[model samples]
Target: MGTCKCHLKLRKPEDAAAACSKVLELDGENMEALKNRAEAHILAERFEQAKQDAHKAHEKDQNDRSVMEMLQRIDRLIKMASRKDYYKVLGVDKLTATARDIKKAYKKLAVQWHPDKNQDNLEEADKMFKEIAEAHDVLGDEEKRGKYDRGEDLNEQPQGHPDPHTMFFQNGGFPGGGGQRFFFRQG
Candidate 1:
């Protein structure tokens, strides 16, 4: 656990994951190990793996706040990835869209995809609503829209924030040997 924490503190999520995995091998039901590994996977942008670990940890302790928070975060990331093309979600042309145009598109889609209006497919509609809202949130704001137009990540990390996905890929940390296929394809 200490080794895992050290690796995480150093922003070496792959190492933390490995250390946590070792602990899990010794005790599959170790809540601490599961929680640590879930966080490590999340830092690595391995949302599915994180979700799995979080689910296990939640099962072990339903009252665990950290576990529940990790699950929620993983779910949000998964939803975001499922509908990554913000322009597509809003049904707007990125190059030609004005703020007004984007707003109109968002409103149209929001009403159609709103979960309350889609009782039979509440889950799907909820996901779509979240995606539409996320798209609009970015495109509606002038500064964020400008950043997006410039090919910058509108959700750019704050200063000194490390991107674990880049680090994981750069260090050849893909789960399987070949590394030919990514576990999670963003967008």
Candidate 2:
């Protein structure tokens, strides 16, 4: 038995990782700590460490989905790391595509590989969708697209962002500074 440290519940990856590491310092074979730390390692992009930690946790508990997902993400990220160029991800040539052209290309590819349209190959479709989403997301935003063009880090937000309010407020501004004042009728 080791010294019991502070018992704190972590809701985020960094905190979880710290707690897990502290626990592991006390007990190396702690499965829960290993899994939590592995997840944090993945979030932190420490793929090799994540893979090792996930493997250890998985060996202890084979039914852990978090461990399995982390392993799969690490494998995919390793593959993607080989093809870091955004143009390659979108299957497009450099300087030949405008933003609209990229959108059209993404739409075409998305429709072709949409999971609903390809029921027999959902996994493949999902992978294609993710690629398309990533490509479109980068190429659609000016800042991200420019970074991507320069081969800089462009893992930013994506495209087709819809308004959450559904155009409730027009360009001319709202009725009474924001909303309308309604008088309730006495029953």
Best by lDDT: 1
Segments of candidate 1 deviating more than 4 angstroms: 85-137, 140-187
How do the predictions measure up, each by TM-score?
Answer: 0.48, 0.40
lDDT of each: 0.86, 0.71
lDDT of the structure predicted as candidate 1: 0.86
lDDT of 2 by residue, 71-100 (tens): 887787665556656566667776787777
lDDT by residue for model 1 (1-187), tens = 8999899889899999999999999999999999989889988989999999999999999999988888877887776566467888788898899999999999999999999999999999999999999999988999987766545556677567558776667667754334575577788
Candidate 2 colliding pairs: none
The prediction achieving the highest TM-score against the true structure is: 1
Any residue pairs clashing in model 1, and if so which? none
Poorest lDDT segment (10 consecutive residues) of candidate 1: 173-182
Candidate 1 local lDDT, residue 176? 36
